[model samples]
Target: MDKKLAAEHLLQDVSHYHGPMIRQMKQLVDIYIKLAELETRREDTNRKVALPREIRSVKQLELVPVVTATIPVDRSCQYNEGSFPFFRGLSDSVTVMNGINAPKVVECFGSDGQKYKQLAKSGNDDLRQDAVMEQFFGLVNTFLHNNRDTWKRRLAVRTYKVIPFTPSAGVLEWVDGTIPLGDYLIGSSRSEGAHGRYGIGNWKYPKCREHMSSAKDKRKAFVDVCTNFRPVMHYFFLEKFLQPADWFVKRLAYTRSVAASSMESIFTFDDIYPLSA
Candidate 1:
């Protein structure tokens, strides 16, 4: 063979050998990038879980169960008639409050003059007339506030023993009997006002119940309720679930990625043919 032709042939052979290897290397690099992304996600989840409860931004107020009584529904009214009354009432109140710009804390008075006298003595200028009358029917402002405060007290007591950075599963189990911490944390249970069911805290408004029971309106009601309330429930549940450390660990596992180097170690051609050679 001619020397030049022989050299050319050898060069072509080398190119053929390296072409697939280059492609494989590119694939390996892509895999590594994916792996790194997965690792970063895992780290973020772990960090979120490790964060202290106080710093987590999951407010106790957010977990407070919506007051059942405050949901307006007239038993005598038809389902469609009462279905949206609760939201309407809220909107009305917001409009009034916007117009009034009432202080964050308002002094409420009973029928008696004595209550008004006491408030006046306290020098509270935020007092409003007939605050109770101003409130949406069936929705008592004080009752909701009181209930929220009570829930906070209970939650604070229950969570007092929960050590920071500890797995929430055991703590949840320990407090399960006292409060449905596990249920709320996991959000496995359906929420009130979900699926056209206007129930909250084991009781549904009589009008809502009647409406939901009607076969003709059931599907529509579900759609409306889910549309209006599902997002609220989702937000609340997600916040609740992330409050625990175990969830963080679970999230990391769910999003974990294999490193590129690890993949290369298992499948690289360097093992068969030394790269140095």
Candidate 2:
């Protein structure tokens, strides 16, 4: 009885502080308490097992019971469950992103007078895999940051919050003042205006375009080219460079340095770097 009283006091003290760990502990406590009540109810018919008045009164702190079923058995369940976490406070005005897909940039206002933005997209591809990779990269970055000896340079992987609404749709945290890497590469190549920014006036592009245009069956020709891609890729590397070879070598090095740092984090693994392809 004394041990139980001491444990309850310790729990109360810990509950005063809030964080992810605290919330997890609270969830475990709630589960245990429910189980204890159930056992007590089964033991004696006359016994009335109830939660403490303090625990019952803290409605906001209580965690809602999770539905284990894949499909909801109750149609009248609250809409907030498994729905977009934020929508009621979203602003009406939305801006379109500059890209082929043209995702929407949505804005929302928080109760604390803070503004949040998300890039919302609806497409056939599921972004859950992207989210998982982002999270994994984040964990790797965290390790690198903590261990300064392993990596001297301060390089952190860029990641954004991803919330998947469904299998085919999702929203990502908006990152401002950034353009696609492909666009940057093209813009750099055409900085002097000697060639089209998107290879419009490039001699190789025109030759390739003419070949496709003059083909008796355009779709079949494209399919054939794609089917045998090695020769096309070889030709591209040999003759279709938008920029000088030195410029490409430098870019390749830059990309490798970032990847190498991440690989170094797991260097202890026997197969971290394969000797042969």
Top-lDDT structure, candidate number = 2
* Tens digits of per-residue lDDT for model 1, 224-271: 545433333334334446666766654443233123223333434455
lDDT of 1: 0.30
**Per-residue accuracy of model 2 over 128-234 as CA lDDT, tens digit each:** 76677667767877886788763575555666776554455666777776655433433333332223333343343344456677899999867654443212222
- Candidates' TM-scores? 0.17, 0.42
Query: Which residue runs of candidate 1 sit more than 4 Å off their true CA positions?
Result: 1-208, 236-277
lDDT score, residue 136, model 1? Answer: 26
CA RMSD per model (angstroms): 32.8, 18.8
lDDT of 2: 0.49
Which residue pairs does candidate 2 place in steric collision?
A: none
Which residue pairs collide, candidate 1?
none
Question: TM-score for model 1?
Answer: 0.17
